[model samples]
Target: MSKINKKSMGQFFTPPQIADRLVQLLEQQVGFALDLGCGRGQLGKSILKRFPLARYVGIEKDREHFNHCANLLTEQTIICADVLEEKALSLISDFMPVDTVVGNPPFLEIPISNHLVLEVKDAIPNFLSSGYKMRSEMLFFAKSLKQLKLGGQASFILPKTFFISEQYRYFREHIIDNFSNISLFELPSRIFSGAEVSTCILYFNYRKTKNQQLTLGCIDANGDIENYLKIDSAAAVTRMDFSYHRLMSESGIRIEESETIGSIGGLIHRGNMSRNELVRKSVPHFHTTSFPINEIEISLDDDVKDGIRFGQEGDILLARVGTRCLDRQVLVTAGKRAITDCIYTIKLPEADIDTVIASLSSKYGKLWRQINAKGSCAKYLTKESLLNMPLFN
Candidate 1:
């Protein structure tokens, strides 16, 4: 494919080495594998090289790549069509009882309605349908699974955010519900070609299992696997409880009647200012995209003037919605600029905003993990959830 066409399709061809590594992982899992979004058949060719007799099905929407190598493998079939197309399902079924499904699908922004970029929505059926959306490259994982048999397996490279992101909570929940074994190989930002998108390789085992425990492993950018993190049948519920307990304990605060002095609603207001406009008006606007709080340079532009301003002295700024990690409550007692709308401004009465800023910089604030819960790049912090965030009075 020409460079321009590939860029338009968001096709970042996987290097032979990376494709080989991913295919090697799948080779260890199953015999028959389906490569969704199989651009140029890089991954499919690698699969055939290792498993010479492997039943490989390479699905590509691009006509250029599909027609070039129709008969490259010993037992591989290349299908050229939209994956979301209804006819694609039948073709996939023909390869039924698939052992492994793998691919690196396109990644893009969320769609509000039927106004999506193309057939990308078909990648993850339930995400947009359930009112949850984000920029995801892992859609191949969810879609490819539909083509697999009961005890099939899947592997794919997806954006790294899926592991720690809150918008992906439902995505994570879905994986846990459907598959029993899920292993993740986290890579640093420099792994992929033409794209610095931080990503991970997810290994999914789709046994005839029902809500089985999952095994998770965190891999570094250089391909070093850390210890595996396992979760049993009750992983979801247990994770929630552990998260709450860990967050509360870090604050050195207990949930008690006496401890509840007043809700955050009394002190915090959703800060409002356009991100681009804020940048035009001022250099720093207590923004999530630019300044995520942990590394904001102390300046005059972030301080509030008189009432409900973006950056102001003694104003605590919290990202109300965006990626889960950035939803953190940040304090800007020194900057003089205004905050963007994505952030909420906390103005306390006779309070030390500096202390609040200090508190947010602590491990307790990091444990909240709510600020980074919504958006694709950044998990958005919901307004309601941030209101309930633990804060020391």
Candidate 2:
């Protein structure tokens, strides 16, 4: 009955409406269902209502939630253990050939525990072979795929970033290549009340076939299912395809293969100056808030020369911290300036800087950046991601 600490357990219980919607997307008859990270059985409850006689198994790591599920859902089998353990796959497979795997897996990055990481690495070697770190939800997706029968299906509520993030490109490739009937249901508005990140429900079958077409769907604010867009599986694995899908779904914009800022001789890199060293030098430096940077004073000492990011006139400064700040574009002019690491100093001549700023500040440019930016509370862009952004001719 106590409030669950979502941060510690990474547990975000699905709302009743969202749970019911996910259940409705499943095939009419499900012989057996596995709830991978069932919080307090909301999703299980919904599934049972839809398929009254379906055999259900719910896994929960937190004792409080496990006990709650046990007390509330007496008819279903609930287990208490970390789902990422080595024995979990075999234990679930003992039930053999699960028809449906459903639940919103935890999304936070697991704490730095070597044993847990190794267990996951051993269990899902192919998913982790990209050398990019794995998230708990990514592991669950792989585990769910492994647990299903050839024709079984999986419906998971996942962060929107899972589809397009550079770090998850390998995982996306795996899903595109190994799964069929790959459908994405994007909910632009926040479904989970307190969760900051936007979410989408992904439904796909375990069957792998070449040249499968992906179905994309969206739920408007009124909960109406919009028309679906079919994309070729070959294109689905590319970054631009994902970006185009999101833009079309959310904003009705279609992006074509075009020249990017990086191609135009513009270099986007993080400000490498140390804040502490800036203060020690007692120089008048520009932070992200110091906009329209015209004049600034600095010591030419060896420490300052070696430590701070010195910017010349005609450079563009972008705030990389919060969403509001990220939208603000500052043009460096008049005098040399030392910028703090909180900002990203773009090195380009005045003409290119002006063009890039005008494009990035435009509607489509902002949309592109928003699609690529990552983070929950304060979204931000990495240097590579920024440089890779499409630049309109």
Candidate 3:
């Protein structure tokens, strides 16, 4: 596959060491093992290597990977299909009550309109609304869990968002409510070649327990777990990443939150237009670059703004998306420029503006964002996430 194609599809074939880690996490030795987004078949190969008698199926969306995996795992059934599709999930009937599920789902953003998501909308709850879409890996994880039988076990090599991001709180809560024996194994950020994505292995048995203790481990380059800890599942519900938990404790950072950003009169608005819209309407438009912003007085076309507030003095311009720049913020200077879509514009009380910005840049703010920010590399913070973030006293 071309580098561009692989990048576009977010395909990072699993390394053999990671495959061993995934296999190690699963407890069941046989019967109905399912691999979703089974890129290049490394995981399936590992599973079958350990459980030779197990019935295994590897599903891959990329035909190239599918063919490669098919050839690689000749003993297992390899199917080329979009795992997120409803048709793909309908196969739960054919392979109902899987004993173990494993895969390294592609890291990509997909719309919520996937037939399966629409079908299960009422059954499953996602925090993202229509405008914001679903993460493909999360969807894959959810679907796999749906097919897992009672007493089944699952272990997937998932991106960091699955462990740390607040956007998927529902998934974390689901794990606590419906599963036990949860263990999260953090992997290196550079685990995948040419990708800087942070990842972890999520292991759980699909059974409930009260006050379950969850294990947090880290696997070094040799695939041997080098560091480990145990904590109550409830304690890690808000932020599951061990690094975050460990850092918070080690640094001795004390944080106190008395209110949310929204409660403090920090009204959030997302930009709602593009360069094309700007060309047609001739309105002042600003992307994330329009900075050193002095007292600005540019606002989107009323219809263009779609009732969203933008472009005013004392407003906070926040970089809404980017792995590196996402946490950046700039005080609106005395000038004229307005942001339309993706980026955020917050209109706050004149008195509260400086304090809010300062608090956001403080140690407490960084700590909150480290866990609350969404996405893997290019982080995304939704308006709701921002508004609901605790404002430290």
In TM-score terms, candidate 2 sits at 0.81
Clashes of each: 43, 0, 11
Better structure of 1 and 3 per lDDT: 3
Model 2 misplaced stretches (Cα beyond 4 Å): 1-4, 87-94, 111-125, 130-133, 187-195, 218-228, 240-257, 273-283, 290-307, 349-351
Worst 10 residues of 1 by lDDT: 257-266
What are the clashing pairs of model 2? none
lDDT per model vs. reference: 0.60, 0.71, 0.73
- lDDT value for candidate 3? 0.73
lDDT of 1 at 94: 62
Ranking by TM-score: 2, 3, 1
Quote model 3's TM-score: 0.67
lDDT of 3 by residue, 1-393 (tens): 886788788888888988887898887666888888888888888887788888888788788889998998887788888876668766546777688888788888876665646544433564344455667776777777777788989998887775665666776787787788999988987788767777899998888898988888789877889888887887677868777666555545433435667887888877777646765777666666654444223332333344433565677777677666565677755553546575788888887877778767666665666556665466678888778666554
By lDDT rank, best first, the candidates go 3, 2, 1
Q: Model 2, 26-112: lDDT tens per residue?
A: 853888998888889998888989999998888887888899888878988888878877775555666866889897998677543
Estimate TM-scores for all models: 0.66, 0.81, 0.67
Better of 2 and 3 by lDDT: 3
